[model samples]
Target: MNPTAPHDTPADLSVAAMTERFRAGDLTPVEVLDAVRARVEACEPTLNALWWSDLDRQGRAQAAARASAERWQAGEALGPLDGVPVTVKENIAVEGVPMPGGHAAGDPPTATADAPITARLREGGAVLVGATVMPDWGMLSSGVSSRHGITRSPLDPSLTTGGSSSGAGAAAAAGYGPVHIGSDIGGSIRLPGTWLGLATLKPSFGRVPLDAPYLGRCAGPLARRTEDVLAAMQVIGRSDPRDFSALPAYTGDYTRPLSDGGADVRGLRIGVHTDAGCGEGTDPHVASVVRATADALSDAGAEVVEIAPFMDEGLLADVDRFWRVRSWADFSALDLEDQRRILPHVARWCMAGADVPAVELMRCYHSIQRMRATTVAATVDYDFVLSPVAPMAAFPAEQPMPYTDPSLPMQHIGFTVPYNMSEQPASSVHAGFTPDGRTVAVQVAGRRFDDAGVLALSERIEEIAAVPAPVRIVGA
Candidate 1:
């Protein structure tokens, strides 16, 4: 910890805190980035959370940091995220950074220009320090992979960080700067956010643009502070001509509601779904934390009601089946040698998709449509629906999924995946901790286009039951 540190150490500085320091002329962008770089350097060897960095981009980051510092000195900040340091998940394309999507095939091509989200971040003055790791093509929920290796949780090095958006979650929890951009198709953002005990928003579909061409994928913000997530979202959610799905006009300043202390849930109806609606039981400790969170919301004057499961058991299996088949189709286009480079699990999934008939795939789409309607209906009467983010907490880093019995198949993705299918706004907030120190997260989901309301409820929950500090990297 720094000798001049205030209430919190630099290692766990929040975006709001850092910006306040800058506004008071007490800190500079370079100083903040230097602290963040030190933290990343100290933790990188142990956590292996990052895939690549912008530091070696011909000194571009250096120039940008200097310019940001000068602006802070002159009281001419660019926007809400001015001088905020952030990390982008490796799957998101940044100009000059290779978006290999964690594939091990050699000689991946670098992105020619920044993805729409990255471009907005640059425009808002959030310094891009690096890119976090993910599984090959973001195929798995766990961080373990053949390409970037395993990404352990900063909370406990032995625990998996939870992926597809693995490194983004790990880095945010390890305090590699305040804000991070994560992509979620099937709970990629919220899963890691849950395991790492950070606040993450999987924005409603089309609330944020899709830079990389893919279905069911949306880029959203992840951060230790909900305020930062909101700030980052304001920038990244801006409409771009490139994205046909972009909202007609940006919903400016997501932090506005929270700033005015308007996120009160006194009259709000929040439904709690713990069984995951798939007939799967949540791990005891995980369920307890979520139940306790519900009680906390009740104490805060919100009407907490136990609700039946909103989704079917087959929802994620179908989604995965569709993705696996789609992934196989894409993999088949690769050369023989490149095909040989794919991860074993990824290949297995791809093969699983290969044999499925076109009619079955069409059935999968209809199922998803039904699932979306059911989820939307479930939340129609309630302001938000609360559930456990996952059936279990973080597991061993070496494993693929946190399944106790491999033969039984894993239903760990029960809660968050349905929200993805529904394309509604959902967030994972730190509910509490497990006996073993792993964090538990409660999912707060709202109707379509209610991204702001979802976040507002999360902020209220945050105020009522505060999240813990970032897990300090031992050596750092």
Candidate 2:
């Protein structure tokens, strides 16, 4: 195993800090990748964060890292994230890996081309370390998929790390790398980031491409710092020929202003969303952490005000229904034999939605339109909005939801789903830890295409929150 930097915290190993070290001749890209690989190896056996390591490609990654190191030595790095080690979530295509999408058994065909976001990572000089696990077609909120089993939280092996970006969150929090590419349709990115105490961005739809066949899903970045997400956004948000969904504006460097000026929350009108219209229950600890984040923003010179749920109850229910039916049909259409390979709860969840009529699906669309209007009206007077990313902290790793009640499908997702409907930029940053030590996260939302603004606010929140300790493998 590669030796540790003396008392290095996860924050100290952030992409920004590592680049500075590289520039100062303190480390090489190969050395950083080696250490990250060591960390991944140590954590993988227990946490199950990875689906495939792509060992055959390590030589190429090392070669790229060496090239990046040479550039850094000559004071000419390739890009903002040159040489940073990054992990891609499994459902997003990586050119040479088997993407099982968390099924129990199948030798899936390797992707012949990289996903647009993956191509962007390469453009930024990021070394793709491996692909991480996700739920079957990213259908569930917990990490217990049929193929990879359960992905435990880095903080506590018995608890969940969140899904369908489950393994990405685990890898990020476990010090596997500084940046992890994840996808979110409902709360996949934010849920895992919240439960695992990492910084993640779910950019405005079209800010990042929806290269895969699914609707409403977008690629995002998860990292130890919001700045890293911003850096990644600058790369992956570029328009690609492969995704007709990508917007054409191509404004340069999402991270430039935030990186140059630092986060300034002053004079911004912020709305706090504690209850997201759905009657979903919130854990008291989660609520307190969110309120504390609002208080911090208020103290940081931003105008903070409490706000009610953005979408109406019926609309919220439709959103849930949409996901249920939509997600089900995507997988249930597979051969009956293949369908049987999915995890029980995930299979059941998808099956429940498979029978919804075409008319019902149209209602879902109508509800989404109404939701977009509601969210726009609510945020029109404000520059940003704040809310809890999830209603609760990490639950048992084996369970599909935070609660056993029948409302489980709608429970944890209430705070996050609206943004997906609104196609707004949203992020989740560490809020605090529960007394039991599970991490809580707060969501920051901004106007459409205002990913930078959302990230800036999240950066401020990250600054005030305590950095989670790096997970140590005891008795390894």
Candidate 3:
């Protein structure tokens, strides 16, 4: 591994900090990537966070970093994330990387072209180290997959790093990489961040372009700090001609000045949903963490109100149907044998999609489309809506994933998924730790295009909570 940079701080240096170091000639991209590579080599045997690592290709990345450093030395301009090393979740295509979608047994075709977001990262001068692991077809909440094995949390190797962005969160928390690019359709990014004590952004739909098949899923980032997330969003947020679903606006700057005072939430109306429309049997720890987070925001000068109407219970079925249709579309392309060989939960979820009638699927789509206006209208008076990312913190990794738990109601995903169905911007910041030592995350939902606002709120909350770096997995 490359020797640590002279001025490199062991911790608290986010991706933005590292980028500044690169620009000031204090660090090199090669050094950053090498450090990450060494960490992965040392940790993967226990954490199993990576799907694949192309060290030879990374050598080429090092050469490219040298060229970028030379250009900067010659006074040429560099992008915001120039020379930063980031990891992409396996589901998103990275040109030349196999698109396993988390099922190693299934011989899915390799991606010939980069996903739009991946291309944007490269254009911004961020080096792609490798693809992080995910659940098979990203169908479950825990990281146990037949393909990649289980991914443990950095804090405790016995606990899970939530999925389907499991590896992304694990890698970030473990300090294997500064930023991890992940996709969230149903609490994937936020849930992991919550469990691992990290900051993650689930941008408004279309902010990051996702080509065919996975279009409904929003691409996002997981990182140690909110600043790194903001820096990454600036790059991957670019509009792509390939995704017809992508919005028409150019990428806007996500970094902004925090509110005047650490306590300045003045005039900002915030809504808190402790019940989260999850019906009965919500975890007390989850409720307590969320309420505490709301109190912190209220103490920060924001008017926090308990609201229920903002959450629509009718939206769950439609969201389920939407995912079903998308999963079916992707699964149909695979050979029958390949389909059979996929993870059990993935196969079960995709099989359910085959049963949904075309008319019913259309109804589900139309229902979601029509409700977006209503959902947006309900939040017009509030600057942001706060809630829990998941019903509970990360659970133990289960072998045969549970698709639908009879004990937990359909609204188990209540706090999330609706925003995805509405295509609005949402984010999760580390609130604090639970009594049992698990991390807790608070969800922030903002206006359709106001992703920056959501990120701003996260930064403020991070200050109030003072989240600590996740504990590295022991004996890895």
Best by lDDT: 1
Compose the digit string of candidate 3's lDDT tens values, residues 386-428: 8888777767755323234422223456677768767888898
Name the lDDT value of residue 106 in candidate 2: 59
Error of 3 at 356 (Å): 3.1
Question: Which of candidates 1 and 3 is the stronger one according to TM-score?
Answer: 1
TM-score, every prediction: 0.94, 0.92, 0.90
By TM-score, who's the top model here?
A: 1
The parts of candidate 3 lying over 4 Å away from their true place are 1-12, 213-215, 258-263, 309-314, 325-336, 370-374, 399-411
Error of 2 at 98 (Å): 1.7
Task: Write down the TM-score for model 2.
Answer: 0.92
Ranking by lDDT: 1, 2, 3
**Tens-place lDDT digits, model 2, residues 241-279:** 677777786775575444325676777788997777674
Candidate 1: the clashing residue pairs are: 277-309
- Writing each residue's lDDT as its tens digit, candidate 1 over 1-476 gives 22133523554667777888888888877787778777777788888888887664356666687888889888899987788888898877888887787888767789899888888889988889888999888877888777888888877888888888899988887777889888888789999988888889998887887665356678788887677788788778777888887667654556556332576667778899788766357889998988888999899788899999866667756766777678888788788898888877677667777788999999988877887887778778987899988888888888877764322323677788777777888998877888877888888998888788788888888788865654554344
Candidate 1 ranges with C-alpha deviation above 4 Å: 1-11, 56-58, 256-261, 404-410
Q: Per-residue lDDT for 343 in model 1? A: 78
lDDT score of residue 53 within candidate 1: 76
